[model samples]
Target chain A: MKKIIKPFWSYDVEQTEDWLQEMAEQGYILKKLHRASRTFYFEQAAPQNLSYRISFDRNQGPVLASRFLENGWTIAAASGKWQILQNSKPANEIKAAPVRQGVITHNRNVSFVFFGLLFYLLGVLLANLSTLVSSWLQDGTVAVEPSPLWAITYLFLALTLGAIGLAIYSIVKIKKSNQAMLQKESGIAAAKWKSSQPTLEIPESSGRFVKKAKLGWMYAPDRLESWLEKMEQQGYQLHHVGTIGTVFYFVKGEPRRMSYHAEYMSTVESSYFSIYEDAGWLKIFESWSAMEKWVIWCREYKEGEEKPRIYSEGSSHLKRARRMAGLYTVLFLPLLFIYAVNANREFQEFINEGAALSLFGLLPAIAFVLFLSFIYRMWAYYIRLRKNYSVFHR
Target chain B: MNADKVMKKYIPMTETAFYILLSLTEPRHGYGIVKHVEEISGTRLHLGSGTVYGTLTKMQKDGVITVFADEERKTLYEMTDLGKQLILAEIGRLKELHRNAVKYEGDFL
Candidate 1:
């Protein structure tokens, strides 16, 4: 038997799965796992081909375990809620793998917990900072504690912040993997035809496709949607959306009328695609964004045909714009305030000292302007939507 | 859960919620609801498991749905009285919608 210790191995599920598979191929089959110490125990075996899947179960119940066994998966090792299931068949041949919903849900819950921890740590840091500030106010010079516990406390804080960062990083990785898997799922991969909706047609214009970069497009999705619509009218129809949803490929063609909608879903439930597809909208591109889903839906219609809309009438879409503006206002207020304060301090320092402009001071000013522009754009976008709403209402 | 609060929130129910609540006429598990929704919708609607799970979790928290472990230890979900009241109110609204649509069908056509 061989015991190996690897800390935080479960953070990257794909990496751990591959590593375990390699170990198995080398005749070191996983026998057991130590949850607390992050240890893996391996038993000697004949070198063989195996497929390992690392899955997390929110319920951590017998149901998932029994399901895996029914599908010919061996429960090689279990650690708390995470289980390593091994199958004799290669991954492609295996008909059943653990459901992705559990892993996605688990990652969401884990991120929330870590965010709470991060807040708690920030509170601790603030308390320490205030303590130092109060002491500095009492005395002209800074004082240092000679105690060894001070070093330990600083080290502890650093480690905790690192761990929280790692948790967030891994959660993002899991979310991306979940998105990849989601694209292959039944509804997302292909819209089923109950009749009516046009298939996603990438117009091939004889090698005349142009790729336009659209980074941060979700910030002003309505603008991007309208821009794409304008392009279609100008005879440059969208051929396909890039894999990351940042770059768009448009093919030159005859001018055609098209409607584009960049829909932001806080949480995409199953059936999201079908309801829209039933209404004849095609999914041109989709991206998993910060645990939310952003889909660019398209539909082509002839003149005199009623344009399809998620909000078919009234100022509902305008209200949505206002709500988005309100949300960003609330979320970015503190960060904006911090940047403004930093910039002001830098400005005062530069004026009083009459020193050369410093990069450190300039950074806060630049960041302040950047965030200010984002907030301003949101408000401007809202105003545009409201105007568009009134035009329709009129 | 307060029937009034649930009624306020769920009136003019979304198609997904209506179908999910409709499925609970029989005690069903989470995935079972998804399958039943598809079956009832004639394969037009495919409910994502995350969507169903999240909805169930919210409903459970609000006391709209109650769950009990079956013999196989799978949690079977059924509607509570509050949920029944909410669904009935939704059905009333939907009936009104159908009536109005039927009455005004000529103009649209």
Candidate 2:
């Protein structure tokens, strides 16, 4: 018998399955896993080549077909929310594999927890920095002395940030791997770009460079994508994007038809890039947002060729729009309430006391109008997306 | 769900939905549905386990199907009253379609 410690195995289940397969090939077959899931016990046996899959189902047993057993798959090990299935045949020969949506969902839920922690830490850091800046402005003290408690707090914050960041990264990686298994089609050759990471830097010898600033383009992704495509058709090719994704650098080139797509995700994973790249899409820019990310993908195409799609299903677009609208409404509702209260209080004071309204008192009213308009725009966008859903034809 | 609500939602259903619900006239498990569908279609269609699983989950939630039994590892599902009405309504629609197609049979190549 042999035992091995792999504490973070769940972070990447496919890799764990691969590791198990390699062990089976080496005459060490997995028997029972530790309850903590960090240790694996294996027994010596004749070397074999076996196919392995890790499935996850929270409430009930994994909903695989009973024919899966007749097809030679056996539940080799089960632990908590994870189950490992092994078959004598290789993966390609197996016709029926359990849907990967369950695993993708599990990892996404876990990432939400880490995302919450990361957001709290960031909020604390931002608040601390703002306080220090305000104090220095008022009393001319930088707070650079670093007291013991402050040092410990900063150190703890840094450590937690690093750990949670790594956890989110692994969760995203495994989720992407599972997504790849959801649909298998012939892979399109990845059109290699001059630069993998978008930046402001450009070689002077490349061409006559033009820098365009387009802030808040992500709020209306379709408009941004069409604008990028229009620029490409005018012979100004996009070279790269700015550090914060607010600017685009276009290089002078021959005119060509191109399609640009902007994709949004709660958490962007590593394999997400690879999958898109394999589908013949040239990644133009990936925005640097911690929680929500927007990726700009483009590919040159002829006038009649099929346009590449990131969100294939029309219903998925509706779902994304609903989520976006819901998020913005939740984020801005409190501010809207505060502004309304202030505006009403000022109005009451002016009416009750016959006091002249101060110019400063109108600021909340203006802000309230602006926030209401923004929320209305979000819902309008969602309605526009729903119109494209072919509701009756379903 | 009532007949009107179910029919409005599922009248224009996909072939996969129609066939899966048809197979559930008798209590059937996951693989049983797949095998039954394949047999009825004369092997013209091979439904993936993933698609079947997903469809079953959606139907169960919409009240078209209910869990009949949880025997060992398999969960068998049976059609509900709303489901029967839905399937029958769909069958009536398909019959009309078939009648029209036969009436205009000479229009084909």
Top TM-score prediction, candidate number = 2
Candidate 1 on A264-321: residue-level lDDT in tens?
6655533345445544567778774544457888889899976555553334456556
Q: Label model 1 with its docking quality class.
A: incorrect
Superposed by TM-score, candidate 2 places the C-alpha of residue B91 at a distance from the truth, in angstroms, of: 6.3
In candidate 1, which residue ranges exceed 4 Å CA deviation? A1-103, A112-173, A180-207, A242-246, A291-293, A313-323, A357-361, A390-394, B10-81, B90-109
Q: In terms of docking quality, how is candidate 2 classified?
A: incorrect
Q: Which pairs in model 2 have colliding backbones?
A: none
RMSD value for candidate 2: 9.8
Per-model TM values vs. the true structure: 0.56, 0.58
Estimate, for each residue in B15-70, the C-alpha lDDT of model 1 and write its tens digit: 77788899999778666787788899998766643346556766766778766433
TM-score of candidate 2 on Cα atoms, chains taken together: 0.58
What C-alpha RMSD separates each model from the true structure?
A: 9.7, 9.8
Q: For candidate 2, write residues B8-99 as lDDT tens digits.
A: 88888777888889898677766677678889999875564334545666676677876522212124567877788889889999999999
